[model samples]
Target: METGAVDEASIDSLTDFYLGCGVDGMTILGIMGEANKLTGEEARAVASRILKRVDGRVPVVVGVSSPGLDNLSSLARFAMDEGAAGVMVAPTPGPAVEDRVRGYFHQVCEALGPDVPICLQDYPQTTGVPISVETILTLTRDCPQIVMLKHEDAPGLRKVSAVRNRSGTSETPRLSILCGNGGLYLPQELARGADGAMTGFAYPEMLVEVVATHQAGDVERAEDVFDAYLPILRYEQQPGYGLAVRKAVLKHRGAIACAATRAPGPRLDATDEAELMRLIARTEDKVKELSHGS
Candidate 1:
Protein backbone atom coordinates (compact mmCIF):
# COMPACT_ATOMS: atom_id res chain seq x y z
CA MET A 1 0.00 0.00 0.00
CA GLU A 2 1.20 3.49 -0.93
CA THR A 3 0.62 6.59 1.16
CA GLY A 4 2.10 9.09 -1.30
CA ALA A 5 5.48 7.71 -0.23
CA VAL A 6 7.32 4.61 0.89
CA ASP A 7 8.36 5.07 4.49
CA GLU A 8 9.83 3.00 7.29
CA ALA A 9 6.78 3.33 9.53
CA SER A 10 4.47 1.69 7.03
CA ILE A 11 6.95 -1.09 6.42
CA ASP A 12 7.35 -1.70 10.12
CA SER A 13 3.60 -1.74 10.60
CA LEU A 14 3.24 -4.36 7.90
CA THR A 15 6.02 -6.43 9.39
CA ASP A 16 4.29 -6.26 12.74
CA PHE A 17 1.04 -7.48 11.27
CA TYR A 18 2.58 -10.52 9.56
CA LEU A 19 4.75 -11.28 12.56
CA GLY A 20 1.65 -11.15 14.70
CA CYS A 21 -0.01 -13.58 12.35
CA GLY A 22 2.91 -15.97 13.14
CA VAL A 23 4.36 -16.51 9.69
CA ASP A 24 7.46 -18.70 9.67
CA GLY A 25 8.97 -16.53 6.94
CA MET A 26 8.25 -13.39 4.93
CA THR A 27 8.70 -13.16 1.15
CA ILE A 28 8.99 -9.72 -0.36
CA LEU A 29 8.91 -8.33 -3.93
CA GLY A 30 7.51 -11.50 -5.36
CA ILE A 31 4.60 -11.10 -7.78
CA MET A 32 2.56 -9.81 -4.86
CA GLY A 33 5.01 -7.14 -3.72
CA GLU A 34 4.65 -5.68 -7.23
CA ALA A 35 8.18 -6.83 -7.93
CA ASN A 36 7.89 -6.17 -11.64
CA LYS A 37 6.89 -2.57 -10.97
CA LEU A 38 9.80 -1.82 -8.58
CA THR A 39 13.06 -0.34 -9.79
CA GLY A 40 16.21 -2.16 -8.75
CA GLU A 41 17.18 0.37 -6.11
CA GLU A 42 13.67 0.46 -4.69
CA ALA A 43 13.56 -3.32 -4.44
CA ARG A 44 16.90 -3.38 -2.63
CA ALA A 45 15.79 -0.64 -0.25
CA VAL A 46 12.55 -2.43 0.57
CA ALA A 47 14.41 -5.65 1.22
CA SER A 48 16.94 -3.92 3.43
CA ARG A 49 14.30 -2.11 5.46
CA ILE A 50 12.26 -5.24 6.04
CA LEU A 51 15.32 -7.32 6.91
CA LYS A 52 16.40 -4.73 9.43
CA ARG A 53 12.96 -4.38 10.96
CA VAL A 54 12.45 -8.12 11.24
CA ASP A 55 15.71 -8.35 13.20
CA GLY A 56 16.13 -12.07 12.68
CA ARG A 57 12.76 -12.94 14.14
CA VAL A 58 11.99 -15.13 11.12
CA PRO A 59 13.45 -16.09 7.81
CA VAL A 60 13.00 -13.63 4.91
CA VAL A 61 12.89 -14.86 1.34
CA VAL A 62 13.52 -12.29 -1.40
CA GLY A 63 12.25 -12.64 -4.94
CA VAL A 64 15.22 -12.26 -7.25
CA SER A 65 13.62 -13.32 -10.49
CA SER A 66 14.70 -11.04 -13.34
CA PRO A 67 14.86 -11.17 -17.12
CA GLY A 68 18.65 -11.17 -16.96
CA LEU A 69 20.56 -13.72 -14.93
CA ASP A 70 23.09 -11.05 -13.93
CA ASN A 71 20.35 -8.94 -12.41
CA LEU A 72 18.91 -12.02 -10.74
CA SER A 73 22.27 -13.09 -9.29
CA SER A 74 23.06 -9.59 -8.08
CA LEU A 75 19.76 -9.27 -6.26
CA ALA A 76 20.13 -12.73 -4.79
CA ARG A 77 23.62 -11.93 -3.52
CA PHE A 78 22.48 -8.61 -2.11
CA ALA A 79 19.59 -10.23 -0.28
CA MET A 80 21.78 -13.02 1.11
CA ASP A 81 24.46 -10.56 2.23
CA GLU A 82 21.72 -8.50 3.90
CA GLY A 83 20.81 -11.62 5.97
CA ALA A 84 17.85 -12.97 4.03
CA ALA A 85 17.18 -16.67 4.61
CA GLY A 86 17.25 -17.42 0.87
CA VAL A 87 16.00 -16.22 -2.50
CA MET A 88 13.19 -17.45 -4.76
CA VAL A 89 13.36 -17.57 -8.58
CA ALA A 90 10.90 -18.39 -11.34
CA PRO A 91 11.64 -19.40 -14.92
CA THR A 92 11.86 -16.47 -17.32
CA PRO A 93 8.44 -15.59 -18.69
CA GLY A 94 7.79 -17.00 -22.18
CA PRO A 95 6.43 -20.05 -23.96
CA ALA A 96 9.59 -21.95 -23.15
CA VAL A 97 10.03 -25.61 -24.07
CA GLU A 98 10.43 -28.05 -21.19
CA ASP A 99 14.07 -28.76 -22.00
CA ARG A 100 14.79 -25.03 -22.02
CA VAL A 101 13.08 -24.68 -18.65
CA ARG A 102 15.35 -27.39 -17.19
CA GLY A 103 18.41 -25.67 -18.72
CA TYR A 104 17.34 -22.35 -17.21
CA PHE A 105 17.32 -23.85 -13.71
CA HIS A 106 20.70 -25.48 -14.27
CA GLN A 107 21.97 -22.00 -15.13
CA VAL A 108 20.14 -20.76 -12.03
CA CYS A 109 22.02 -23.29 -9.87
CA GLU A 110 25.32 -22.12 -11.33
CA ALA A 111 24.38 -18.47 -10.77
CA LEU A 112 23.21 -18.83 -7.18
CA GLY A 113 26.02 -21.30 -6.48
CA PRO A 114 25.96 -23.89 -3.70
CA ASP A 115 26.20 -21.56 -0.72
CA VAL A 116 22.85 -19.89 -1.30
CA PRO A 117 19.89 -22.26 -1.00
CA ILE A 118 17.22 -21.86 -3.66
CA CYS A 119 13.45 -22.10 -3.80
CA LEU A 120 12.41 -23.03 -7.33
CA GLN A 121 9.13 -21.24 -7.99
CA ASP A 122 7.03 -23.42 -10.33
CA TYR A 123 4.24 -20.97 -10.98
CA PRO A 124 3.26 -22.01 -14.51
CA GLN A 125 0.24 -19.76 -14.80
CA THR A 126 2.36 -16.67 -14.21
CA THR A 127 5.66 -17.77 -15.70
CA GLY A 128 4.29 -19.65 -18.74
CA VAL A 129 6.97 -22.29 -18.18
CA PRO A 130 6.07 -25.64 -16.70
CA ILE A 131 8.70 -27.71 -14.89
CA SER A 132 7.57 -31.31 -14.88
CA VAL A 133 8.03 -33.63 -11.91
CA GLU A 134 10.89 -35.52 -13.56
CA THR A 135 12.73 -32.26 -14.33
CA ILE A 136 12.35 -31.12 -10.73
CA LEU A 137 13.71 -34.45 -9.46
CA THR A 138 16.66 -34.21 -11.82
CA LEU A 139 17.44 -30.63 -10.80
CA THR A 140 17.30 -31.36 -7.10
CA ARG A 141 19.38 -34.47 -7.63
CA ASP A 142 21.98 -32.60 -9.68
CA CYS A 143 21.96 -29.45 -7.55
CA PRO A 144 21.74 -30.07 -3.85
CA GLN A 145 21.49 -26.30 -3.46
CA ILE A 146 17.82 -26.50 -4.40
CA VAL A 147 16.18 -26.83 -1.01
CA MET A 148 12.53 -25.92 -1.66
CA LEU A 149 9.84 -25.94 -4.32
CA LYS A 150 7.02 -23.39 -4.54
CA HIS A 151 4.48 -25.58 -6.38
CA GLU A 152 1.60 -23.61 -7.95
CA ASP A 153 0.70 -25.58 -11.04
CA ALA A 154 -3.08 -25.42 -11.47
CA PRO A 155 -4.89 -28.75 -10.87
CA GLY A 156 -1.54 -30.03 -9.71
CA LEU A 157 -2.57 -32.21 -6.81
CA ARG A 158 -1.38 -35.31 -8.61
CA LYS A 159 1.88 -33.58 -9.45
CA VAL A 160 2.44 -32.98 -5.76
CA SER A 161 1.93 -36.64 -5.02
CA ALA A 162 4.26 -37.66 -7.82
CA VAL A 163 7.04 -35.41 -6.56
CA ARG A 164 6.72 -36.64 -3.01
CA ASN A 165 6.69 -40.22 -4.18
CA ARG A 166 9.80 -39.70 -6.26
CA SER A 167 11.57 -37.92 -3.44
CA GLY A 168 10.77 -40.79 -1.14
CA THR A 169 12.01 -43.42 -3.57
CA SER A 170 14.89 -41.67 -5.35
CA GLU A 171 18.30 -41.18 -3.85
CA THR A 172 18.04 -37.40 -4.44
CA PRO A 173 17.65 -35.09 -1.49
CA ARG A 174 14.03 -34.10 -0.82
CA LEU A 175 12.87 -30.54 -1.42
CA SER A 176 10.27 -28.90 0.74
CA ILE A 177 7.17 -28.49 -1.41
CA LEU A 178 5.02 -25.47 -0.63
CA CYS A 179 1.79 -24.72 -2.48
CA GLY A 180 0.84 -21.31 -3.84
CA ASN A 181 -1.97 -20.19 -6.22
CA GLY A 182 -3.54 -18.01 -3.56
CA GLY A 183 -3.89 -21.15 -1.45
CA LEU A 184 -6.90 -22.14 -3.57
CA TYR A 185 -5.74 -25.77 -3.82
CA LEU A 186 -3.98 -25.92 -0.48
CA PRO A 187 -6.12 -28.62 1.07
CA GLN A 188 -5.74 -30.98 -1.83
CA GLU A 189 -2.07 -30.14 -2.23
CA LEU A 190 -1.43 -30.88 1.44
CA ALA A 191 -3.38 -34.12 1.22
CA ARG A 192 -1.27 -35.04 -1.77
CA GLY A 193 1.93 -34.45 0.25
CA ALA A 194 2.73 -30.74 0.04
CA ASP A 195 4.77 -29.43 2.97
CA GLY A 196 2.85 -26.16 3.34
CA ALA A 197 1.73 -23.03 1.51
CA MET A 198 3.46 -19.91 0.19
CA THR A 199 0.68 -17.51 -0.67
CA GLY A 200 0.09 -13.74 -0.35
CA PHE A 201 -3.43 -14.04 1.02
CA ALA A 202 -4.43 -11.34 3.51
CA TYR A 203 -5.63 -13.92 6.04
CA PRO A 204 -2.49 -15.90 6.76
CA GLU A 205 -3.88 -17.13 10.05
CA MET A 206 -6.38 -19.17 8.10
CA LEU A 207 -3.63 -20.78 6.05
CA VAL A 208 -1.67 -21.57 9.18
CA GLU A 209 -4.74 -23.09 10.81
CA VAL A 210 -5.58 -25.21 7.79
CA VAL A 211 -2.04 -26.55 7.51
CA ALA A 212 -1.76 -27.12 11.22
CA THR A 213 -5.11 -28.83 11.53
CA HIS A 214 -4.46 -31.06 8.56
CA GLN A 215 -1.03 -31.96 9.81
CA ALA A 216 -2.57 -32.72 13.18
CA GLY A 217 -4.55 -35.46 11.37
CA ASP A 218 -7.92 -33.78 11.66
CA VAL A 219 -8.72 -33.40 7.96
CA GLU A 220 -12.34 -32.50 8.55
CA ARG A 221 -11.43 -29.70 10.95
CA ALA A 222 -8.84 -28.43 8.51
CA GLU A 223 -11.49 -28.26 5.82
CA ASP A 224 -13.80 -26.54 8.26
CA VAL A 225 -11.33 -23.68 8.66
CA PHE A 226 -10.59 -23.63 4.96
CA ASP A 227 -14.26 -23.64 4.07
CA ALA A 228 -14.90 -20.77 6.45
CA TYR A 229 -12.52 -18.55 4.54
CA LEU A 230 -12.85 -20.04 1.03
CA PRO A 231 -15.33 -17.40 -0.15
CA ILE A 232 -13.00 -14.50 0.57
CA LEU A 233 -10.07 -16.54 -0.72
CA ARG A 234 -11.76 -17.09 -4.06
CA TYR A 235 -12.89 -13.46 -4.28
CA GLU A 236 -9.32 -12.30 -3.72
CA GLN A 237 -7.86 -14.60 -6.37
CA GLN A 238 -8.88 -12.47 -9.38
CA PRO A 239 -5.87 -12.47 -11.69
CA GLY A 240 -4.96 -8.91 -12.72
CA TYR A 241 -6.96 -7.32 -9.90
CA GLY A 242 -5.97 -9.58 -6.96
CA LEU A 243 -3.19 -7.46 -5.53
CA ALA A 244 -5.40 -4.41 -5.16
CA VAL A 245 -8.04 -6.53 -3.46
CA ARG A 246 -5.44 -8.02 -1.09
CA LYS A 247 -4.10 -4.61 -0.16
CA ALA A 248 -7.63 -3.40 0.46
CA VAL A 249 -8.33 -6.34 2.76
CA LEU A 250 -5.08 -5.85 4.64
CA LYS A 251 -5.91 -2.16 5.07
CA HIS A 252 -9.38 -3.05 6.30
CA ARG A 253 -7.91 -5.46 8.86
CA GLY A 254 -5.41 -2.75 9.96
CA ALA A 255 -2.38 -4.60 8.63
CA ILE A 256 -1.36 -1.63 6.48
CA ALA A 257 -2.05 2.06 6.26
CA CYS A 258 -3.52 2.43 2.78
CA ALA A 259 -4.80 0.36 -0.11
CA ALA A 260 -3.26 2.55 -2.80
CA THR A 261 -1.20 0.87 -5.47
CA ARG A 262 1.71 2.47 -7.34
CA ALA A 263 0.76 3.21 -10.94
CA PRO A 264 -1.16 1.04 -13.45
CA GLY A 265 -3.48 -0.43 -10.84
CA PRO A 266 -7.20 -0.81 -10.54
CA ARG A 267 -9.26 1.16 -8.07
CA LEU A 268 -12.17 -0.34 -6.14
CA ASP A 269 -15.43 1.47 -6.94
CA ALA A 270 -18.40 1.68 -4.58
CA THR A 271 -19.91 -1.51 -5.96
CA ASP A 272 -16.64 -3.35 -5.62
CA GLU A 273 -16.31 -2.20 -2.04
CA ALA A 274 -19.87 -3.26 -1.28
CA GLU A 275 -19.29 -6.71 -2.73
CA LEU A 276 -16.04 -7.15 -0.82
CA MET A 277 -17.56 -6.02 2.48
CA ARG A 278 -20.40 -8.46 2.07
CA LEU A 279 -17.96 -11.32 1.54
CA ILE A 280 -15.90 -10.15 4.46
CA ALA A 281 -18.99 -10.16 6.69
CA ARG A 282 -19.92 -13.64 5.58
CA THR A 283 -16.37 -14.89 6.16
CA GLU A 284 -16.36 -13.44 9.64
CA ASP A 285 -19.58 -15.25 10.50
CA LYS A 286 -18.35 -18.51 9.05
CA VAL A 287 -15.10 -18.38 10.98
CA LYS A 288 -17.02 -17.68 14.16
CA GLU A 289 -19.33 -20.58 13.51
CA LEU A 290 -16.43 -22.94 12.97
CA SER A 291 -14.67 -21.72 16.09
CA HIS A 292 -17.82 -22.43 18.08
CA GLY A 293 -17.96 -25.97 16.67
CA SER A 294 -21.26 -25.30 14.93
Candidate 2:
Protein backbone atom coordinates (compact mmCIF):
# COMPACT_ATOMS: atom_id res chain seq x y z
CA MET A 1 0.00 0.00 0.00
CA GLU A 2 1.32 3.43 -0.88
CA THR A 3 2.00 5.83 2.03
CA GLY A 4 1.29 8.75 -0.26
CA ALA A 5 -1.94 10.70 -0.30
CA VAL A 6 -3.68 9.55 2.87
CA ASP A 7 -7.40 10.30 3.20
CA GLU A 8 -7.86 14.00 3.96
CA ALA A 9 -10.69 13.52 6.41
CA SER A 10 -8.64 11.09 8.42
CA ILE A 11 -5.63 13.40 8.34
CA ASP A 12 -7.70 16.39 9.35
CA SER A 13 -9.30 14.66 12.32
CA LEU A 14 -6.06 13.06 13.49
CA THR A 15 -4.15 16.31 13.07
CA ASP A 16 -6.84 18.17 14.98
CA PHE A 17 -6.61 15.68 17.82
CA TYR A 18 -2.84 15.98 17.97
CA LEU A 19 -2.70 19.70 17.37
CA GLY A 20 -5.22 20.29 20.12
CA CYS A 21 -2.97 18.48 22.57
CA GLY A 22 0.53 18.98 20.97
CA VAL A 23 1.67 15.58 19.65
CA ASP A 24 2.80 14.53 16.18
CA GLY A 25 2.06 10.79 16.02
CA MET A 26 0.23 8.41 18.34
CA THR A 27 1.27 4.81 19.09
CA ILE A 28 -1.63 2.41 19.50
CA LEU A 29 -0.78 -0.45 21.83
CA GLY A 30 -1.65 -3.69 20.07
CA ILE A 31 -4.11 -6.23 21.46
CA MET A 32 -2.97 -6.49 25.08
CA GLY A 33 -2.06 -10.10 26.02
CA GLU A 34 0.42 -12.87 25.56
CA ALA A 35 1.11 -13.70 21.90
CA ASN A 36 0.42 -17.44 22.02
CA LYS A 37 -2.54 -16.79 24.26
CA LEU A 38 -4.30 -14.85 21.46
CA THR A 39 -5.39 -16.45 18.21
CA GLY A 40 -3.98 -15.20 14.91
CA GLU A 41 -7.44 -14.25 13.62
CA GLU A 42 -8.18 -12.46 16.90
CA ALA A 43 -5.02 -10.40 16.68
CA ARG A 44 -5.70 -9.37 13.11
CA ALA A 45 -9.24 -8.42 14.01
CA VAL A 46 -8.04 -6.19 16.84
CA ALA A 47 -5.50 -4.48 14.55
CA SER A 48 -8.17 -3.98 11.89
CA ARG A 49 -10.45 -2.23 14.38
CA ILE A 50 -7.71 0.19 15.40
CA LEU A 51 -6.73 0.99 11.82
CA LYS A 52 -10.34 1.46 10.83
CA ARG A 53 -10.86 3.83 13.75
CA VAL A 54 -7.79 5.75 12.67
CA ASP A 55 -9.22 5.74 9.14
CA GLY A 56 -5.96 6.16 7.23
CA ARG A 57 -5.46 9.62 8.57
CA VAL A 58 -2.31 10.68 10.46
CA PRO A 59 0.36 7.97 10.07
CA VAL A 60 -0.87 5.23 12.40
CA VAL A 61 2.01 3.15 13.79
CA VAL A 62 1.06 -0.25 15.25
CA GLY A 63 3.13 -2.02 17.90
CA VAL A 64 4.26 -5.66 17.58
CA SER A 65 5.74 -6.85 20.91
CA SER A 66 5.21 -10.59 21.14
CA PRO A 67 8.02 -12.57 22.79
CA GLY A 68 8.67 -14.79 19.78
CA LEU A 69 9.42 -13.80 16.21
CA ASP A 70 6.54 -15.91 14.91
CA ASN A 71 3.97 -13.86 16.83
CA LEU A 72 5.73 -10.56 16.11
CA SER A 73 5.78 -11.42 12.42
CA SER A 74 2.13 -12.31 12.52
CA LEU A 75 1.23 -8.97 14.08
CA ALA A 76 3.53 -7.04 11.74
CA ARG A 77 1.98 -8.74 8.74
CA PHE A 78 -1.47 -8.03 10.13
CA ALA A 79 -0.62 -4.35 10.55
CA MET A 80 0.63 -4.10 6.95
CA ASP A 81 -2.44 -5.92 5.65
CA GLU A 82 -4.67 -3.58 7.63
CA GLY A 83 -2.93 -0.48 6.04
CA ALA A 84 -0.88 0.81 8.98
CA ALA A 85 1.51 3.58 7.94
CA GLY A 86 4.28 1.83 9.85
CA VAL A 87 4.99 -0.92 12.39
CA MET A 88 7.05 -0.61 15.57
CA VAL A 89 8.77 -3.80 16.76
CA ALA A 90 9.27 -3.40 20.49
CA PRO A 91 11.64 -5.83 22.23
CA THR A 92 10.16 -8.17 24.80
CA PRO A 93 11.17 -7.33 28.37
CA GLY A 94 13.85 -9.52 30.05
CA PRO A 95 17.52 -10.13 30.69
CA ALA A 96 19.90 -9.14 27.90
CA VAL A 97 19.90 -11.82 25.20
CA GLU A 98 21.47 -10.39 22.06
CA ASP A 99 21.17 -13.34 19.71
CA ARG A 100 17.54 -13.96 20.54
CA VAL A 101 16.64 -10.29 20.00
CA ARG A 102 18.55 -10.03 16.72
CA GLY A 103 16.96 -13.22 15.45
CA TYR A 104 13.52 -11.87 16.27
CA PHE A 105 14.11 -8.68 14.26
CA HIS A 106 15.54 -10.66 11.36
CA GLN A 107 12.37 -12.73 11.30
CA VAL A 108 10.25 -9.59 11.48
CA CYS A 109 12.09 -8.08 8.49
CA GLU A 110 11.60 -11.21 6.43
CA ALA A 111 7.93 -11.39 7.35
CA LEU A 112 7.22 -7.66 6.82
CA GLY A 113 8.78 -7.66 3.34
CA PRO A 114 10.81 -4.80 1.88
CA ASP A 115 7.78 -2.77 0.91
CA VAL A 116 6.45 -2.23 4.42
CA PRO A 117 8.76 -0.09 6.54
CA ILE A 118 9.52 -1.01 10.17
CA CYS A 119 10.65 1.02 13.17
CA LEU A 120 12.82 -0.46 15.91
CA GLN A 121 11.57 0.63 19.33
CA ASP A 122 14.54 0.97 21.75
CA TYR A 123 12.88 1.43 25.11
CA PRO A 124 15.31 -0.16 27.57
CA GLN A 125 13.61 1.15 30.65
CA THR A 126 10.30 -0.54 29.87
CA THR A 127 11.59 -3.51 27.88
CA GLY A 128 14.67 -4.34 29.99
CA VAL A 129 16.53 -5.09 26.75
CA PRO A 130 18.68 -2.60 24.91
CA ILE A 131 19.60 -2.93 21.24
CA SER A 132 23.23 -2.05 20.62
CA VAL A 133 24.25 0.37 17.86
CA GLU A 134 25.95 -2.49 16.03
CA THR A 135 22.70 -4.47 15.98
CA ILE A 136 20.73 -1.44 14.81
CA LEU A 137 23.20 -0.78 11.98
CA THR A 138 23.06 -4.43 10.92
CA LEU A 139 19.27 -4.42 10.83
CA THR A 140 19.10 -1.19 8.84
CA ARG A 141 21.78 -2.32 6.42
CA ASP A 142 20.27 -5.75 5.90
CA CYS A 143 16.64 -4.71 5.96
CA PRO A 144 16.00 -1.82 3.63
CA GLN A 145 12.43 -1.70 4.93
CA ILE A 146 13.53 -0.88 8.46
CA VAL A 147 13.43 2.91 8.14
CA MET A 148 12.85 4.43 11.59
CA LEU A 149 14.10 4.09 15.17
CA LYS A 150 12.04 5.25 18.14
CA HIS A 151 14.72 6.22 20.68
CA GLU A 152 13.42 5.93 24.25
CA ASP A 153 16.78 5.48 25.91
CA ALA A 154 17.94 8.10 28.36
CA PRO A 155 20.59 10.40 26.85
CA GLY A 156 18.83 9.46 23.61
CA LEU A 157 20.88 11.92 21.57
CA ARG A 158 23.96 9.77 22.02
CA LYS A 159 22.09 6.80 20.58
CA VAL A 160 20.77 8.96 17.72
CA SER A 161 24.28 10.16 16.85
CA ALA A 162 25.64 6.65 17.04
CA VAL A 163 23.08 5.40 14.52
CA ARG A 164 23.71 8.29 12.15
CA ASN A 165 27.50 8.09 12.46
CA ARG A 166 27.53 4.35 11.83
CA SER A 167 25.29 4.70 8.81
CA GLY A 168 27.85 7.27 7.57
CA THR A 169 27.97 8.49 3.98
CA SER A 170 25.94 5.66 2.56
CA GLU A 171 23.84 6.54 -0.49
CA THR A 172 20.72 6.17 1.64
CA PRO A 173 20.54 7.23 5.26
CA ARG A 174 20.19 4.15 7.43
CA LEU A 175 17.34 5.27 9.66
CA SER A 176 15.13 8.08 10.82
CA ILE A 177 15.24 8.71 14.57
CA LEU A 178 12.14 9.84 16.44
CA CYS A 179 12.31 11.01 20.04
CA GLY A 180 9.93 8.88 22.15
CA ASN A 181 9.95 10.62 25.52
CA GLY A 182 6.95 12.73 24.59
CA GLY A 183 8.17 16.35 24.70
CA LEU A 184 10.46 15.98 27.68
CA TYR A 185 13.69 16.38 25.74
CA LEU A 186 12.50 17.31 22.27
CA PRO A 187 14.66 20.41 21.87
CA GLN A 188 17.85 18.51 22.56
CA GLU A 189 16.71 15.56 20.46
CA LEU A 190 15.96 17.73 17.45
CA ALA A 191 19.21 19.61 17.88
CA ARG A 192 21.07 16.28 17.83
CA GLY A 193 19.32 15.39 14.52
CA ALA A 194 16.01 13.58 15.19
CA ASP A 195 13.56 13.66 12.29
CA GLY A 196 10.68 14.25 14.69
CA ALA A 197 9.10 13.23 17.98
CA MET A 198 6.36 10.78 18.96
CA THR A 199 5.15 11.80 22.36
CA GLY A 200 1.91 11.23 24.26
CA PHE A 201 1.17 14.60 25.79
CA ALA A 202 -1.25 17.56 25.89
CA TYR A 203 0.21 19.90 23.23
CA PRO A 204 1.07 18.25 19.94
CA GLU A 205 0.65 21.55 18.13
CA MET A 206 3.56 22.88 20.09
CA LEU A 207 5.69 19.97 18.89
CA VAL A 208 4.65 20.52 15.31
CA GLU A 209 5.61 24.13 15.73
CA VAL A 210 8.93 23.11 17.18
CA VAL A 211 9.69 20.79 14.30
CA ALA A 212 8.32 23.00 11.57
CA THR A 213 10.04 26.10 12.85
CA HIS A 214 13.33 24.32 13.35
CA GLN A 215 13.16 22.73 9.94
CA ALA A 216 12.33 26.12 8.45
CA GLY A 217 15.65 27.36 9.89
CA ASP A 218 14.31 29.01 13.01
CA VAL A 219 16.09 27.00 15.72
CA GLU A 220 15.83 29.89 18.13
CA ARG A 221 12.04 30.00 17.89
CA ALA A 222 11.79 26.22 18.24
CA GLU A 223 13.94 26.21 21.35
CA ASP A 224 11.89 29.02 22.84
CA VAL A 225 8.65 27.16 22.27
CA PHE A 226 10.06 23.95 23.72
CA ASP A 227 11.22 25.75 26.82
CA ALA A 228 7.76 27.30 27.16
CA TYR A 229 6.19 23.86 27.21
CA LEU A 230 8.41 22.61 30.06
CA PRO A 231 5.88 23.31 32.78
CA ILE A 232 3.30 20.87 31.38
CA LEU A 233 5.96 18.31 30.45
CA ARG A 234 7.33 18.34 34.00
CA TYR A 235 3.84 17.79 35.40
CA GLU A 236 3.33 14.75 33.18
CA GLN A 237 6.51 13.14 34.49
CA GLN A 238 5.46 13.24 38.13
CA PRO A 239 5.86 9.91 39.93
CA GLY A 240 2.72 7.77 40.25
CA TYR A 241 0.75 10.30 38.25
CA GLY A 242 1.63 10.44 34.56
CA LEU A 243 -1.18 8.88 32.54
CA ALA A 244 -3.78 10.10 34.98
CA VAL A 245 -2.41 13.58 34.51
CA ARG A 246 -2.56 13.21 30.71
CA LYS A 247 -6.10 11.81 30.77
CA ALA A 248 -7.21 14.56 33.14
CA VAL A 249 -5.80 17.22 30.82
CA LEU A 250 -7.49 15.58 27.84
CA LYS A 251 -10.87 15.44 29.63
CA HIS A 252 -10.57 19.01 30.88
CA ARG A 253 -10.05 20.10 27.29
CA GLY A 254 -13.08 18.00 26.17
CA ALA A 255 -11.04 15.70 23.95
CA ILE A 256 -11.45 12.14 25.24
CA ALA A 257 -14.25 9.87 26.46
CA CYS A 258 -13.15 9.68 30.08
CA ALA A 259 -10.11 9.83 32.31
CA ALA A 260 -10.49 6.06 32.61
CA THR A 261 -7.35 3.95 32.32
CA ARG A 262 -6.77 0.21 32.50
CA ALA A 263 -7.08 -1.34 35.93
CA PRO A 264 -4.36 -1.70 38.62
CA GLY A 265 -3.74 2.03 38.23
CA PRO A 266 -5.30 4.51 40.57
CA ARG A 267 -7.63 7.20 39.31
CA LEU A 268 -6.84 10.84 39.93
CA ASP A 269 -8.11 11.62 43.43
CA ALA A 270 -9.71 14.94 44.38
CA THR A 271 -6.36 16.54 45.17
CA ASP A 272 -4.87 15.24 41.92
CA GLU A 273 -7.85 16.45 39.96
CA ALA A 274 -7.69 19.85 41.58
CA GLU A 275 -4.00 20.18 40.91
CA LEU A 276 -4.39 19.12 37.30
CA MET A 277 -7.18 21.60 36.83
CA ARG A 278 -5.06 24.35 38.20
CA LEU A 279 -2.25 23.43 35.86
CA ILE A 280 -4.66 23.37 32.94
CA ALA A 281 -5.94 26.81 33.79
CA ARG A 282 -2.47 28.23 34.00
CA THR A 283 -1.51 26.50 30.76
CA GLU A 284 -4.54 27.94 28.98
CA ASP A 285 -3.64 31.40 30.16
CA LYS A 286 -0.09 30.93 28.95
CA VAL A 287 -1.32 29.74 25.58
CA LYS A 288 -3.47 32.83 25.30
CA GLU A 289 -0.58 35.06 26.16
CA LEU A 290 1.67 33.35 23.66
CA SER A 291 -0.98 33.50 20.96
CA HIS A 292 -1.40 37.20 21.43
CA GLY A 293 2.34 37.77 21.46
CA SER A 294 2.73 35.86 18.24
Give the clashing pairs for model 2: 21-202, 21-203, 21-204, 22-203, 22-204, 22-205, 23-204
- What's the TM-score of every candidate structure? 0.96, 0.83
Query: Clash totals for all models, in order?
Result: 0, 7
lDDT of 1: 0.87
Which digits, one per residue and each the tens of the lDDT, describe model 1 over residues 136-229? 9988898888889999888788889998988855497878998888899888899999999888999999998899989999999898889899
Candidate 2 lDDT tens digits, 201-246: 6666778889888888889878877777778878986645687787
Residue 162, candidate 2: how far off, in angstroms? 2.1
- Model 2, residue 170: C-alpha shift (Å): 2.2
Please give the distance, in angstroms, between residue 224's alpha carbon in candidate 2 and its true position after superposition.
1.8
Candidate of highest TM-score: 1
Lowest lDDT 10-mer window, candidate 2? 1-10
RMSD of each: 1.4, 6.3
